[model samples]
Target: MIIIVFHIDSQERTYIERITQDTAEGIKTLLKNDLEKRITSLSEQSKLSVISSGMSQSDWDAISKNLYGTQYGYQAIGWIDSTFHVRKRIPKHNNEVTIDFNLALNPPALLTAIKAQDTQQRAVTMPLAFIHGDEGIGIHIPIFNANTRGNKLDGFISGVLLFKPYIKSVVPDFLLNEYYFTLFIDGHKVYSDQSNQPAIAYAWSKSSSYYLQGHEWEINVSPNDEFLYIAHYKVMRILIALGLFITFIIVLAAYTYLFARSKLKDERYKIEHLLKNLPGMAYHSSNTINRPMILVSDGCENLTGYSRAEFKKNRMLWRKIIHEDDFKRVEKSLNEAFKVNSPFELEYRIITKNSSIKLVWEKGGPVSSIFNGEIIIEGFINDITSIKEAEADLISSYAFSDAVVNSVVEAVITIDQHGLIQSFNFAAQVMFGYSADEVKNKNITILMPTPFCDQHDQHLAQYLKTKQTHIIGVGRELIAKRRDGTQFPIHLSVSEIQNHENTMFVGLIRDITKQRASEEQARLHTEQLAHAERVNALGEMAAGIAHEINQPLTAISLFSQTAKNFCEKGKLEKLPSIFEKLSLHSRRAGAVIERMQLMTKKGQRSKEVIDCIFMIKEVINLAESEARLRNITIRMTACDEAVDVFVDRVQIEQVILNLLRNGMEAMQLNTCDNGSKIELEIKLNEDKNVEISVTDTGAGLAQEMRERLFKPFSSTKENGTGIGLSISKSIIEEHGGHINFCDNKPTGAIFMFTLPIYEKRSRE
Candidate 1:
């Protein structure tokens, strides 16, 4: 019932006395003698020793109580059927377990060691017990026994028993049964029946390099095989299967896509047979390719004049075959197409092997992405020489036609069906006082005066309706007003000109005011010379008539004188009648002399400004006697407003009188039953020109004679001189005007003369 303990370090035994209450030798001797006797006595179950010995009193007392009964003679010994070594459970970490012992001593007993073969056979020596030696002072240690007591014996011989190694050191598994078993899973508590029990010690069984005599022992279970197996095994298996399946699908899809793409490309190659034959032609833009070229057409040979073999030997041959001037342009277009990813087509000239140039048409577009580079360009080329030549010829022809139009002298203007001037020549611009830029698109009627405003439009409508052209075919001499509001005569010859498919009119215009003026002056000059000659002859003829009439008058006078004397001697009234007859014969001789004198005088003066209507009235008055004799009425509507004109009054009046006499002669000479009527019209025109017209209703002048009516001696009268109208023109034109002869409606000729009016000076 007593416990004894000792701690000894044999390597440092100098401190053993301080650690232990007894000396080493003294304790050894006391334990060998007295401790043995006491132990024998205890084994014999006798009374305790009371002699003075090497042991302490407390030790003696404790040992005595454990072996014998107490002082009461009460028996303390008891026989047990079974002995159990209740050990504390070991803790597991990784795959091992550790048992920590809490004995009452620091050093356990040392003794001879023995070996156990297996776990079952080694159980008897596995559990340890405490024992005292023969010394009076004894220490405690372990014994390898399967059964042991846990009374006051635990105060000594305390050491570890492990079911497995400590996971850090190697220990015998037989001795491990000294400790209790425990089980855990992933740090979760399971079974620990002896978690709080003390660890049972085992005695050193043998002296071997594999075992320690007085050291701790540990138990171990490998972590890889125990807890971790159940924890992550399921997750690892699922992940492995899923990864394998995903890898299979990815590989299969990649193979299928490559195979399909290859088949599609092969089919496309057959369709583009021409593109495959050309060797140097590239699909993508590169100098060389392990892959086949794209869009290389067979016609490439014809275009470049180089065989496929020659180009394949040198990939740059295709570029060399292109015309030098066109190479840059083609390269620029290719670059642009690549940048924009759009289709491109163009025509350019390319040089051939024979040093001849061929016009080639090229087309290209972008293709796809490759190896982190956009090196794709698709294109084709072919000859286009014929097409380009045709375009050039058409352009040349247009230029020639334009030259002809620009060179015309007359003011040529072209008008469309709408009457708008489309093309106006230089002359047309100048004549119309507008630049080509100003009037090219203006209406044709812009050159016309008002009221004649829409007249051109109406005329065009009439012409379109009637299918006849009055102004188109023939040149019409007409008067048109200028931009300055002055009237000028011009002859416009318009013709309908047709183009490739449309109808247009070209107006050829000329100014004719000068030409007409020249004709008038020539006619007057001829009339003046003819009139002078006729007047000279008429004077000579009148001289002969005067002489002949005077001789007859002398004979008649002598006969009348004799008759008068005979009547006077007879002294009858018959003498007075005879005298009256002699007086009448004297007056007749005087009238003949006066008529001859008037015809011989030829002192004519020039023209001056005069009142035209007043002059016409005086001329009518002079012709009145002749009109009355023919039973004719000469009517006059001379405007009462004074129409002052630049002309000779005498010559204009003479022209009027001759026209009146001619009308009377035509009436009498034609032997018409009703006497003729004459009409005279005079008015001042709005343009400051005077009009004097003499019209007769007698037989009209024939068209043929009217053409020459103003010529000298070109008259229809029996004794007429055409000098009167000729002189009238000469005088009127001296003041810058004109005379015109026309036929009056239904009959006679109308003589009309226009004289420039004299504008009076302002009174201021």
Candidate 2:
């Protein structure tokens, strides 16, 4: 018995060892594949940089900025002069500084490749070190000028790599911790990972060397013994127990043989009885239902709640036992089986003696009757009532899921792994103007335009190969084609689900055509309202602007007449001075009218960074004549300082003019006994914002008027369009500012607004 058990144990051990060896080999292959793939990718990227350097100067200039340090590793590229001085560096230095390649190159990495100057286009790697205070690993690919046949190397496309991240990214930390590993490049120890005082020792190891891009990497690794022990511990115990049980059974074999002869007869009789009393009904009946069954088993009691005697007497036709709905199905199945002489199997419902329905599966075929030599139906019936109940519940759930798909407003579509449409819901049918039957088995590209349609298959095929997805599990805005060939913007979100053997994608799409149209209309309406406000402001100040221009015209006329008089009296010597005065006033009148024309220009608003103080001073100059006519003295409290804001200059000027004119009118409505004053003030606030305020001395605004002052179409003046203050509020807010009301110190309303200071960030 001991010898027998020993043989079994040896066989099991051999099989287990073969499986363990296979697993270890598989792990080694996977690791080697990863290392080679990553290194090959890095080598290809270096060559691409060399290619870009040869293309054009602009492409070369942008190399450093485009380098992905976090994704790939730290890197740099430069152009070197014949003197070995770095002439251009990507991700430029903070200040003008030169890198002397003569000192930066160590014993033999980049220096050897540069000095070789051969046309073979080889790559060299340099160790990490600080050259002028920056530490990095450099890989130099020599760039030779393409214009000349044997031109000297122009420069190098350098790769600065972070060692630890670059190495572990290809072979992760988990792999390092699980196995003992050492890596060498060019006979130098680049990285070595091993656990000291490991739980188990390494009993075996594997070593390999790979050469890539003229560089050699040697790798040695060994599996962890403790992990292998834990993996096989329970399996060994199970096999040992099985071997012991088999040995015990072998020892009892002789004793069991002696008792078997005596008990065989009695057991045969019992087995015969058991065979006749199986669960489910068995029957042999004639082809005609009116004939009595040739033989029926006792299981008819459980199957139909009727005795075998009732079926043998032909008291009821076997066809009448089938449920009403399933009568035709059962007859059809039997007819097909008889015609082909094949096995008959069917699932249908039957009515029991108590009028209760029980789902049953019947299986058998036509056989020759042993007594009469006539064909007969021989079959067994199994009660499948529970299975039928489960099917009913599943059908109910399918109905609920269909209801949900039909209720959604957005189009929902499902596609198979081949990009063929599998399910198109009601919304999708309506959106694409195609029914589910029309689009079924069609590729999803039919609903998309050129570039998207062409690239979709490529994207899907790549994902199937690499298991990497960019558009799946995200929402993207794209253009979709309708049945009428019209293209419109749609928001689409796709999700992937993997079921058993196939993959499926579900996409939800929403049409955004109306939404985009509404946004454009709103923007156009805003521009039209701002232009109208500028025109209205110019209309209110027309008389004052006329007076302002007439004064300059009057001066020019007086100066010209004086100059002519002097010429007539033979006083040509004074003519030069008079002529100078005439020229000054002539230019001044032209300036006034030009400013007015700019303020009311009918066009789109243009935004730029302008000095806020200078613009306010200009508005003040434009409104002085009107203020003086109303007996209001306009004063600038702090107009000399410089503050910059980004805004539409003309629109901002109109806002300032409207406020000053509104203040002057308010003062006139409630006349001040000591004369009215409109003062303009600007100050830089603690929050780095420009605050401008217009104050007037008059009867203050009523509590009721203050609440609705900025609301559209609510105004204090009868002739006012009621949109000026509202439009002013919109303009200021659009420029990243807010305008509102404040109480003046001496009992009047002050209109105050704040604007963000312009910040220059293009360089930073």
Candidate 3:
């Protein structure tokens, strides 16, 4: 009896030890999982709040309050700035003391924060005493500047984890009552449910270790007095009582057999209960054509919406529930597994009794039933519908993003912090003459030319280090190289993308080669049109120029003849005066010829600063002869101060001349009873710009004519080419000026134009 009692006690002790070990392991897992979730939530919040460069106090307050509201077991949640100052704390009624508190005073917390920044990862500090006299550990998650290129630490999202409340929340209620648990962090006892209880030297106890954030955590679990009495002493006393009631040998044999059978039944019951409560279904099935299930857990109803009895009664029901598209593959896998007597795992779709589809993952192996010595299948089937759905959603999102990027006309390229190409859209591939695969993972400098390619890395490094931007978020026209070793102009605009892991730069690029070509073509066409109009204007003024030149030539002829006659008649004294008149007349003719030549010259338009008054005077001189011949009196109004303007001399002169000639022609046609007159005025307007006006005493323009006045191919005169006014408008606009015509006070037309005043810096 003593030997039997000793053996029974030994068995009880073994079972108790096993249970404690499992409990300790469970507690450790729960703590680790809970801590991980909190860390992840804090990290995500940190990322969101720093999107605008730095987090405001209100931002921190909102984030901390939200976290505190959603979760429990935190003594306090707060934000710490880069300077180690605690800027904001939640549950402010009690935690106000922590506000503005510098973390530098707490060596452990400060070290943890520094470690988090250095590793760019979340970290936890050693156990410490909280201000409220609670024992806890601090967790720090580093926040970084999202706009910057590097992982520059902006601050930390920190939380104080109260050991007692935290551990109570994680450990199941049933476990707390049955077992005494003690938690240790780095060999320091931080929490214990029963402080008076003996340590690990006790017979029924187990210990497990968990590593988190550089801290070694240990959980020791031991059975309480009630559990110890039930598991060990009670069973031993009952067996001893039974041994005393019967003959020694018979009682010994009966007790041994009954105890073995009872233990077997209890173990079986435990396994069955565990399987029934599992999150997924477990099954034992016969290896037959339809794979009829011999046993199925209660979880069958939850997972498949069918009872275990239904699965057993209808052998073909399980086979029918498999999705049509996936049944064949499932069967093939099972058949292969049976052939090799090996385990098999598969993921496939199934339809529940309610006709709802689900994705399930199954793991099974062939097993021989002990009762009948027949091969059977034992397996676990878990519903994985949510996981599969999440995967599909992620894939669809990526596909949609890719479609949008590739469809854009502008090339899209993304590069990592090191300037290595990460993504190359279809447009980028076509623009750069390289395949997506060829450019992926290559340095962005590969698509740049000589100096840019050489300096690209240094520029990127500098931006990352200093967070100073030159081209990021700004557009620039730069040279880019193609796979064919050709360089072309490209307009590039870069933007930064930041996440917890790293920084990325997205560039929108346009190949401006064709755009540049088109602009050059338009410029050349404009120059041609202006030159053509200048020549045409000279043609129209041919008669006026000839008459003006004739006067100067005739005067020279008369002077020279007089000089010769005086010399012949011995009038030497008057000869010097005649020679002087001759020289003056010759110079007058030469000046007219030079001005005409300048007007006819055609070349690229070059702008320079010149006095507006002087330019207008030259135009009047050329038009004066024509004005007089047409019975028109020309008048001038001048400003006392010189008005300087930046303009092409020839272009401005052409515009002025065209307006003067038009005024003369308008008056000639009207033939007013009062002698016709044209007024030319140059003065500064309110805007400090040079304003030139020409007024003609003729019939003013009609409403319809004014609307299309500046348009090409529209004119009001009888023998007009219709291009003079259009060319004049273009010339004025090109020189940063505008021309418009308005009605004169009484039966006349007034044409006014304004030119921007040139500053000295503009000439440079």
Deviating ranges (above 4 Å) for candidate 2: 1-74, 80-135, 138-339, 345-361, 366-436, 443-445, 450-478, 490-519, 538-700, 728-764
Better of 1 and 3 by lDDT: 3
TM-score of every model versus the real structure: 0.32, 0.52, 0.47
Clash count of each predicted structure? 37, 0, 0
lDDT tens digits, residue span 1-764, model 2: 56765775676556545544544454446545654543444445545655432345576655544544434434345555434455555545531343445534555644645553454454545444535344334555455557668765566555545455555665656666656666667777665566362534444455667665566666666556554444444555666788887888887797689778889888988865764787788888888744357677778888898887888887766788888899887888888999999988899998999999998998999999888898999988879998888999999998999899989999999999899999899998889999999899999999998889999988998998898878798789899998888899999999998989999999999998998899779877877887888777778788888999999899988888888889899999998888888888888898888888888787776799998888898998889878878888888877456788898899889899999988888889888653577889999877879999999877778888888988989888889878889888988998889898888866887898989999777422
Comparing 2 and 3 on TM-score, the stronger one? 2
RMSD of 3: 25.9
Error of 1 at 75 (Å): 99
- The 10 consecutive residues of candidate 1 with the worst lDDT sum are 201-210
Model 3: weakest 10-residue lDDT segment is: 48-57
User: Native-vs-model 3 lDDT?
Assistant: 0.86
Clashing pairs in 3: none
Model 1 stretches with alpha carbons more than 4 Å out: 1-320, 342-347, 360-407, 457-468, 479-487, 499-501, 519-764
lDDT per residue as tens, model 3, 1-764: 78988988888888888888988888888898999999998888876655232557676667677888887888888878888888777877767778888877878778888888998889988998876677899989887876678866778888888898888777888899989888999999999989788543355778999899778999988998888878888998788777666667787798899799789889988997899789999999888766778888899899989888898887436787789999889999999999999999999999998999999999999999988999999999999999988999999999999999999999999999999999999999888899999988999999999999999999999998999999999999999999999999999999999999999999999999999999889878777787887787778778888999999899988888888888899989997778888888888888888888888887676888899888888988888877777877888999998788889898899898888888888778788544477899988889888899999888778788877888887889776668788888878887788899888887888999999998774211
**Candidate 2: what lDDT?**
0.75
CA lDDT of every candidate: 0.53, 0.75, 0.86
- What TM-score should be assigned to candidate 1? 0.32
- Highest lDDT model number: 3
Question: Which regions of candidate 3 are displaced past 4 Å?
Answer: 1-388, 407-409, 416-420, 441-480, 489-505, 512-519, 559-584, 672-675, 762-764
Clashes of 2: 0
